[model samples]
Target: MIRIENLRKTYGKIQALCGIDLHVPAGELFAYLGPNGAGKTTSIRILTGLTRLSAGAAALNGHDIAAQSTAAKRQCGLVPQHVNLDSELTVGENLDLHGRLFGMPAATRRQRIAELLAYVELGDRVHSLVKQLSGGLKRRVMIARALLHNPRILFLDEPTVGLDPAIRRRIWSLIKQIQQQGTTIFLTTHYIEEAEFLADRVAFLDSGRIVAVDSPTALMAGVGHWAVDWVSDAGLQSAYFPSREAAQAAGAARHNGFTLRRVNLEDAFLTLTGKKVATDANAQTVHGQGHGAHAAATRNPTGGQAKKGH
Candidate 1:
């Protein structure tokens, strides 16, 4: 339902996206995995008409994003990484505003708002101000608002970025539910396990390029079924093995302690890029580095600055 060919985006001397190609079939849950500054958000911005691409083409469903911008945009909903809802607006009011922006009729807006609020399990918070909701509740409200228009595709950019693990899992289940209902989902996240657990297929992006695209299991298999990690003079290190027995044998040889675990999506990414996908320190660093450039690069396509926090 989504297609891209030789997509490129440049911000001054920084090449945010470097001629990448990707396709996500209808009803598929596709994950774009990368560390910050890897062009994941840049790609989303282009697809959603929030920013212009420097070269190449992207289409939603079958409409070209640049040529048929309205049709292309109509096919997708976006839940941005940060909370962008109006703090003063009540939950229902926030969703109602989005529905109206989509030109939804008042009756339809009310119906959809109610349905989506219930779907996201926020039926009781409809009258609460956005600022009064917890982080997890706000995230749920965002999801509901994004779905207010019933777009066929949903783009969740770092959907659970700051939520606790338990809340993240709850959001994960909600995401899965949406996929089951036939929405083609495009997710970008730094959390390795999130992609591993949720995506039917995942693409690893780095330095504005796509290095690999495959099923999570296939990607993990490429790096072996098991991993043995140990602390070394060079810092933490890992070895991949084809089987648990092999991993155990390898670990037994180490004089120091080792961690024996199944090879995961993080291991696959590390093997390919020599960089960790998600770390507390790394997340903080990258989140702080790109705001200025990002703001400068984005254009609303509606004769105004794109909304902040998106």
Candidate 2:
């Protein structure tokens, strides 16, 4: 339901997008995975008519974003990174206000607000002020407000960035439910696990261009090698091969028996970008704000900015 071709955006000397080309099929949950400044937000802004493109074109539900700005926006819902709701407003009031802003009929707004509150599990707290809610609750309220108009496509920017593990999983399940009902979801997130679970297809961006776009399984397979590890007399010897069978063959040639384990998205990420991230639990974290992976000079169409992190 969305198409972008050679979409370019420049802010004076800073080029946020470098002629990106992408397509999202109707009802697909597509994830844009990248570091902070990789132009994920820039792309979303342009698609939502918040930012103008310097060149190329983008359309939502077959309507050009630039030429038919209002129509394009009407078909889309956005949950931005920052919370923008009035803290003093009650949950119900906030949703009601947004529904009114969208010009939804009173009867329709009432029904949708009820459905949205229940969907977000905030039905019991409809009368609670936004300022009185917890971090997770506030986030849910934001989501409900976005759904007030029931747009065809939903764009979420770092939806679960600061939530705890439990709340994050809850939101993940909620997103899946939304997708099951046939809403096209375009999401940007720092959690690789979230992308693995939610995205039907993922586009990994670096330095304003897509390095790879495919199903998660296909992307993992393209990286090559199973990445098994075992402590032996050699002390952490690493090997690379064309496939798991080859890696196993090399292992057999060197050792009697070794434990083999499957690799994950983190391994694929490391192979693609060649940088190791540090998470709190000793496991690798996703990229931080402004961490640029290797940029292919050939991929940039405009080459407008020197380099800036999102």
Candidate 3:
């Protein structure tokens, strides 16, 4: 479980988080939705102790994040937005190293490695070097490493970023399995549908502040059931309606590029924040659109996988 109250963070003149307050119950999958600089990663960093908060209180499970840093950290696992697995190491080697860092016993590490490799369906890649594996496989390895300690909560910041749709779904299924196993999951993603499909509740944040939080269905319903999109003087414009007949009526009177579709979580986010989710693909056109590289950086400037761990 995770809880926050009046969470605020600042970097000199820039305010990254402003009075954020939220709660995620145990075994629930909570998605944090926002565009770039919307405080998604900043909030994740603060929760994971990678970045400190300026003023606020946060707790992981039952431990105070500030006053009980070690215990709080031990309560959660983080899979960063970018891939951080060492390319030179084999899949098994990468996981083994993570276990060692957690001070896991040799026998325990071996058992956990075997179990997780099968859980992620990467058993055959046990000896395969990380560089030789596909992007999807590498991501599975990241999840395995993050779960090595079997923490009570998981923090996934853009977990499916940069992957193709098919591979992204595989990761989504894995995340769902983890949640079914009773791990609290806190996820941040630019892919609007990903949140809708995977999250039990969604929160929209803008300019470092939380604007709305609710189930994806409730949020979408708040706007309307249908959306009519068409070209306007201001370029692309969309209108929301409570019924398909209303949207169809509007579409009949519109010019080219008119489309009548069900309103989505993206519509809810756009209504609340006036900004679109990060993606070259239109989030409104389909139900399962992924953002690819428009979602998150695949690697650091060094052209290598960056490091992320406890």
lDDT of each: 0.87, 0.76, 0.84
Per-residue lDDT for 1-310 in model 1, tens only? 9999999999999999999999999999999999998999999989999999999999999999999999998899999999999999899889988998899999999999989999998998999999999999999999999888999999999999988878988999999999999999999999877888899999999989999999999999999997776666665678999998898899888876666667788789999999888774433333233222322222334322221211
Residue-by-residue lDDT tens digits, candidate 2, 47-78: 88778899999999999998898889899998
Residue pairs with clashing backbones, model 1: none
lDDT of 3 by residue, 142-238 (tens): 9999999898999999998878878988999999999999999999988888898999999998899989999999999999998776554555577
Taking all chains together, the TM-score of candidate 1 against the true structure is: 0.90
Find the number of clashing residue pairs for candidate 1: 0
* Clash total of candidate 2: 3
Best by lDDT: 1
* Candidate 2 vs. true structure, TM-score: 0.81
Kindly report which residue stretches of model 2 are placed more than 4 angstroms away from their true locations once superposed. Answer: 229-261, 275-310
Which candidate, 2 or 3, has the higher lDDT? 3
Clashing residue pairs in all predictions, respectively, total 0, 3, 0
Which runs in model 1 stand beyond 4 Å of their true positions? 280-310
lDDT for residue 268 in candidate 3, whole number 0-100: 89
Residue 66 in model 2: lDDT:
88
Q: What is the TM-score of each candidate against the true structure?
A: 0.90, 0.81, 0.90
